[model samples]
Target chain A: MSWVNWILVICMYPFVLIMYFCLKNEGHDPKKRVYYGVSLSKEQAEDQIVTEIGNAYKKQMKRLLWISFLTSVPVLILPSFSIAFTYWCFWFLFVCFVFFWPFGIANKKLREVKLEKGWTTGEAQPRYTEIKEAAGIRKVKWYHFLGPVVISIACVVWAVLQPRDGREAMLIILAATFGGMTLMFAALAFWMDKEKTAIVSSDSNVNVNYARARKNMWKNFWVAFAWFNTLYTVGILFYQVQESEVTGMFWLLLGLYILFTVILLVWVIQKSKALEERYADKMDLKVEEGDDAHWLWGMLYCNPKDKHTMVNKRVGLGTTINLATPVGKGVAVFLILTLLSMPVLGIWLILDDFTPIQLKVEENCLVAKHVTEKYRVPFEDVREAQLLTKLPNIGRNYGTSMDNVKKGNYRLRDESISCEVLLNPENGLFIRLETEDEIYLFSGFDDTETRQVYEAMIK
Target chain B: MVIILQDGSEVPVFKQIRNQIVMGISDGRLQPGEKLPTVRALAEEIGINSMTVNKAYQLLKQEGYIMTDRRNGVRVRESFRMTPELPLESKEQLKQLVSEARVRGVSQEEFMALVEEYFSAGQRE
Candidate 1:
């Protein structure tokens, strides 16, 4: 690499660090406290504390950004010297170190906030809500993944196609790909933040924003950093092994680097485990007192008459409809398809040929001929129905299914039906009517109840 | 009776619910026979945890201020009554208020005369 290229890379380090801290510290803000029809003034002790923490976080972020910009100035000038490469690399590493410094400080401040005020204190309460708000609309708004996916593909193709002098190019391409992947991973983290239930436990004493952002940033950084380092190390190894002219000193340096990286990774993993254990120990699981009737309160589409409706505790679906388990079935389908294609594709690649897997609907069933001998009932046969009792492992143990049914666990009255059928140990057909349209075929039912239910449903 | 829960108020939500219910009962705005909203309804209305509303109701029941029947749901206790006796300090404060009024150029005769006039007018209406 030219001196200018090295300088440019060094110059970008502080900016990257600043960006990291900015993203990490983004969620720390005091939420406006509300009590009995009145807005509590920030003058209140708890509110004041929250304000101070938020202000401190903001100030720290500002300072970190300023320092990053200042550090970047030296790299822009492109220092002309014999040790320019070393100087540029060291400066780049320093910038990366500084980028995470604010996050470390913020983490400490969060610990302080947790200690000084009780974990469930007002200042700590609002952090999660604030972070959720800051995360913006839930879906992955940033098209970060596309760039990484493209770059990764390009790097792989280039490495395969190019015969000689491609090692250095591959290393640079792989590094850029890693960077792009980091951005994509960060976007995914934000997306997960949106989808996951914002359950800020009442007993959590620390500011949620401080805790959540810290946890998320640390998680994202280390995961990305580790993966990047691993890939870079592999790339370097590949280059050294492939090239005939690599020096003995380079091999020595690579060995030491690998050893140091492994040690650091181990330490991080141990620290993370300890932190998780500590949190688990401190967390209290309290059963909040309330009638089950109150559970439906403030819920969307909840009517007084809908009190008896049996809702899925897992999927949050009401008894009246079968909502697609969000992202579950789709992901399952993708995985199944991928698994089936892998062997075929691998073999085809060796033969330098390909054949597309065909899906066919036979007798109202989706049959996969080229893959597993599995078939799915057509959509028309699928009924949206609720079980009379909570399916085993579905409902709260404290509540009896019979009592709920007696109290009126209204099930969906859909026309379409699907049954899950299975064979028993005695070779009897054990058919489970899953929906109105489809029957799942399986084996090992304890009794004849499964056959009886299936017979009743089909009849 | 409408009860407003201030989300930003320093008081906890349950306490707010309890205090409002108490105030409503004492002021006779909530009648003895009247049914209060279910815990779920109340919580939904106030945008608070239903458990908090349940807590308030539980407290009210323990205080003999409300009754809950599974069939009829929650209602004000039929025999619920606030103690009529004024505290000694309050009685003393009343005496002080009368004395202050007397000092401020109002006599007992004038106060009685005004009271009689109001009563006579009410009777005529």
Candidate 2:
């Protein structure tokens, strides 16, 4: 297999690993029955029933694994789509079939087992009072915000120092976005830090330690994210300087980010588990299930009671919006619109390869048209129009190019003349038109059309 | 001070917040001139509507229980004086309480003691 194919295979590893872990750890899930009100001891027959349930779960999981493996073969072997589409398919299958289906099944089975064995009890005792009010904002040191402040300053400085270029401008925008996000995350961290139990527990020491550890983890995660963003911004700038396409480096960086995220998630889960284990003896295992029911898919919080647009996830992993609120709904709509626009963008990009560029010399003007853009040059404003046998080294101001076809506004590096460019690099007339205000660059994609358009324009 | 909103309560959320703050100040749980959280901060912390919290703050400020400054968002009024005029609703509530005490077959001395207990309860803290 080629190196590209190897990268593709490697990219599939995370999904495989996630599926393996999900299936492998199914048996180890805590069997703590949330029996409401009445506390019941394990009966002699309960063990047998539990064992039966466990065995059934394991069997079902194994069967699912085999089925999933068989089903994925076709999808895996299917001709290459976009990498994003492939990864999305893997994720969708894992979530919908492998994870969600089995999880729902097990949950249903567990409920059924509890009901059959007469283990279910009365209504849950209210424990909202004991759930503890989150303490007010804690005093945050100035240094906690230093990383975001520094990144913000650096982004501003970089943007100000860099010469005006579209690619450079995009880089600066990305950096600014990253810096803004970092600052928001930093602010969120400080806000979340204030969440403490109102009731002083007998295990205050352990609680303090746990809180500290979690806070430190959050701080480190944000700092790491900031550094990663900085490096990525720098990478893009470097790629632009090298005059190289960003696709390969972009994918590599994205892959690294995904890998890092999975590792971070695993680390957080482990740490949280350790904290829970240490405090299990001291703290009550059950409490008021505050707003847990409103959460859909264990991620999206849809609480109308929450006034804030953004909130920390219950798992202390990341932020989630209260989607019931107007602001959250707006964000959700914007995100959906962005996602929906991707296909149109992809189609446009693909069409650029096939779309024929046409330059029509009419009675009063010359009209240049491509799939992505069109430009009209008035005869009155056109100062000079020339057809060159060979094109100069020109950079794209804003347009599309694939292999031999280049059509857009371009800047001539040697002459420093802005022009309309419509050129097929292989075999086309390089038409450089200098209008009164600006230069119009055009290059035709077809060799015949190029010669015809050149001859027509010159005549 | 932490404000807990009862999900099942018949009272509206804004009223609950207002009542709680009033109770806090009367009982000295919230001291005179104590700085209260910003409306937004409190709203976020309690996971309640900011408008509800703002309404509560507005009520408190109007009643001379709290004061607001440009730099310091809101605070318990240092003057800490109750309005001279009591609302008719409060008067009616007091009348109802007295009538209830009389109907319950309690002596005037016992009723007075009960009233004294409640009034001093706020001063204990």
Per-residue C-alpha lDDT of model 1 across residues A1-459, encoded as one tens digit per residue: 344434345435434643554344232312312111112233432555545755665676677667666655544454332233334445545554554454445444544544465543343121111111222323333453444445455555555564443233444555455545555555444434433222223332332432454345344444545355445545643553342333344434444444554454445445544543445444332111111112221121222321222221211111111122333344446655755554454343322211222333456543322222244455356553222222221111111112111111112213222222212223333332355433343322223454444333443
Task: Give a tens-digit lDDT track for model 1, residues B45-125.
Answer: 343467988999998898788999999988988775658676586599779878888889988998789857855654411
Cα lDDT of model 2 overall?
0.59
Considering every candidate listed, which one attains the maximal DockQ? 2
Name the runs in model 1 displaced over 4 angstroms. Answer: A1-27, A32-66, A72-82, A97-459, B1-125
lDDT of 2 by residue, A123-158 (tens): 322212111123333445558677556866687578
Fraction of native contacts (fnat) of each candidate: 0.00, 0.13
**Candidate 1 DockQ score?**
0.02
lDDT of every model, 2 decimals: 0.43, 0.59
Clashes of 1: 45
| Fraction of real interface contacts that model 2 preserves | 0.13
